[model samples]
Target: MLVAVVLAVAATVGVVLFTRVATRPEPAARPTAPPPATAKVVRTDLVDRVEVDGTPGYGAATPLSGRKQGTLTWLPEPGKVVDRGQPLYAVDAVAVPLLIGSTPLYREIRADVPAGPDVRVLQENLVALGYAEAGPPDGKFDAGTGRALRKWQKAAGLPQSGVLAQGDALVLPAAVRVDRVTAQLGAAAEGELMEVTGTERLVTAELEKSRRDYAPAGAAVEVRLPDRRTAAGTVRSVATASAEEGETKLVVTVAFADPAAAPESGQVVVVLTGARRDQVLAVPVRALVALAEGGYAVEVLRDGGRSLVPVEPGMFASGLVEVTGPGLVEGAEVVVAS
Candidate 1:
């Protein structure tokens, strides 16, 4: 009986040992995927751009009125480029030339005229035309002014009366391209005479008021032309007045650096580039992982092990996002989810 009992105890022990061996788990397999494809952190330049639809055409249309009323004998054709000394239109067979000045000719300009801004305008033009041989530009129209006026009149085939009528010349701030002529050859030169715009082509866009901060005067921009060509442009003007609709909107005008490269009139894309950073640390946007708490983080691979690193995300361009964090350096491997 003792022998039998000892044999039974040995059998029970053997069965327990066999069950433990069968239930034991195997060693974990080594990962073969290399911790999900990884990308290297790089230091490069980044530019954030906001693209908006824009119209490519003349900058702004300015109305040109006839200074004097008379029969329109001649008018510049639409699309004609009028320079400083060129005739913008003719009244009663008399050509009214264009002069560059901000001050309009409110009254007749002639010798013995009192010193005023208008007098200065005439004097400046006279000096520029080599007609004023007496002295520098001055507001007073003296005897030298008379000689210059008569010389200019003679050259322009006008009566050498040394007197400038209020409508004798069309004054503009700068040279312009004739956009439209309102009056016909035989029509009366009265009221609105024509329309003009800057010589260079520009792109105009209406930006939402909320996004007004995105575009400011002098901001650099990129224009994509109809031919798929890209051109550099600058924000020339931003209208303070907002158009009232469901949402307020502001007008933004961008002038192309190379006007000749711009299409005459068509729809284009205007990309407003924001602040740029050079030699900044950046990584693939996919590598970024949102932390459960609040900010963002990235999985950094170091010494065959991955560590969750907190990062401050910044401007994003292309597929890369700017990031800054502790121990984040160029050429650092970052794990990205497949």
Candidate 2:
């Protein structure tokens, strides 16, 4: 009877333990997130580019020379930064004879009576020619210099105003733009010449033939000057035919957009020939999954859950494709990996 009671109690205890163990709850599985999107591509219809090289050149050049056969009275070529409308060349071709003290430009500086043999000859010749009879054969300009001005004006068909006029710019044989003048009031000479450069112009560049096709019509360009400053320009002209220097061919001449910054002759520069776009979106090639519906799909992370985002793939590529899809903006976080 005692053995039976022990066996029954042991059985009841085992049942209670087994029932408690079975009632305990199990741990839940953690959820995984969706992947991100990354691709890169450029729209073919948008911007195009071309590259080239060139040297700066002036748009126009005017040459200046003496109008009369008088001596080259002034030597002012080497160190003059002439301003527009400033005088460059001067000659003392007076006729009727000037007073001893008449040099308009050099009133401060004491001038020797005879500047040199050539000047002396010029003075004598001017007096004999009736350009000026005022100054001594001392070869200096004086008050009588106006006679030389009148004579030159008459021969060149210019106004006898004596004050140099604009049309007189053409009378110079050497060819240049006239910037300024210091005519002796009474001095006389047969004719005189002076010239100045224009305020605006362009520099040309030579490019390689291989880069020619990319050289677009109306493409934007930059002209680099000797001072390391860059001026903007356009691709003005591109040659259809090519020139060969040994085995290499060269394309010729790219005109500048801005003439204000061009360098002096023989100045070399690089031509930047393209435009840039901003705020473009890009992604890696593997990030894209082609959906069965023929559209593109990317895994998006939203509300702590991963979901399939159907995207319209327009500009796609091998490595990275340019993406434009719904709810896609800069800084919008997306899951790139599963």
Candidate 3:
């Protein structure tokens, strides 16, 4: 009977202990909160600018061919600036002067040649060179034209043939700078003679076809040179066709108002301005919070506490948004979601 009493007491103790352990109230559930990411509201100027890769060089190099079929006795050195009425190269020891015109002197321009646009080009050039007081009557090869030709030939130290030959002069649209000379002393001038470019320095950039309007003609821009210096530029031309053989990027040429402002060759950065906001309160665009009703608000942390302050957003630029509100001020901390 004593052993039975002891066993029964032990059994009752085990049951009470089990019930107490199971009935113990779980530790009161504690609320958990994570620290919010934050950023400071800043007051500054914001500019919406687009930067594109560019190359600084003399616009485009165009190949210059000689119409004269003879020995190349003279060629200009590379980088030489040749102007109107100047000798581009010598053919058969005869200097072929440069002329400003659109039409080439195809046929022999003599007093008997029929009146044509070529004659008009020759006559106008003679007038501009001061060889003649005025152009030929009705652009016809007349007695006045012969007198001007003889004067020009004499001034150039050439024989007074009184007749303009087919290879006597080279006509181009404007003044050019020699980029390269393919003809050597005594080489044949029947083919390519040299390559030339415009005298102005230009920055060429390949802009995507979709953003074609970003660089329209006459748009003002800033060019950051390879040396980190910046200069002012304007869009000179935007190619209507593709700039590459197998691409669709439009070629944009930006010209420096002063050609001397840019280097001859280097990589460049073209900054195009879109919009700007001056001295406005702004924050990282990610700092904005959407409201349940409508509009946007920012979770501002102040006095060791946080609250949502409604904000009116304005111009957005460079990953920042302009904000305006009664409570929004510079140096205020706002939450930005990572």
TM-score of each: 0.76, 0.32, 0.70
Show where candidate 1 strays beyond 4 Å: 1-35, 52-56, 185-188, 203-214, 222-232, 240-251, 256-270
Q: Would you give me the overall lDDT of model 1?
A: 0.86
- Rank ordering of all candidates by TM-score, starting from the highest: 1, 3, 2
Report clash pairs, candidate 1.
Answer: none
Cα misplacement distance, residue 229 of candidate 1 (Å): 5.7
For candidate 3, lDDT tens digit of each residue in 1-338? 99999999999999999999999999988888878888999999998878899998877788999988889999999999998889999988999989888888899889899998888888888888896643743669888888888898899877798888888888898889999998788988878899999888799888778787678789999999888889999999888555557777777899997677887777899987766789999999999988989999999998998899999999999999999987888999999998
TM-score of 3: 0.70
Candidate lDDT scores, in order, read 0.86, 0.48, 0.87
Per-residue lDDT over 314-335 for candidate 1, one digit per residue giving the tens place of the 0 to 100 score: 9889889999999999999998
Better of 2 and 3 by TM-score: 3
How well does candidate 3 score on lDDT at residue 52? 93
Q: Write the per-residue lDDT of candidate 2 for residues 1-338, one digit (tens) a residue.
A: 99999999999999999998999787787878434453323333323344345655433334343343344344345324443223344444222211111222221111333254334443444465456553466644444544665565576444565443222222212223234443333334334333344334455555565666556666666666666777776665555444565545544445566555566665656554443434456555565677786888766656777667666654443344566777665554455543
Q: Report the Cα lDDT for residue 247, model 1.
A: 55
Candidate of highest TM-score:
1
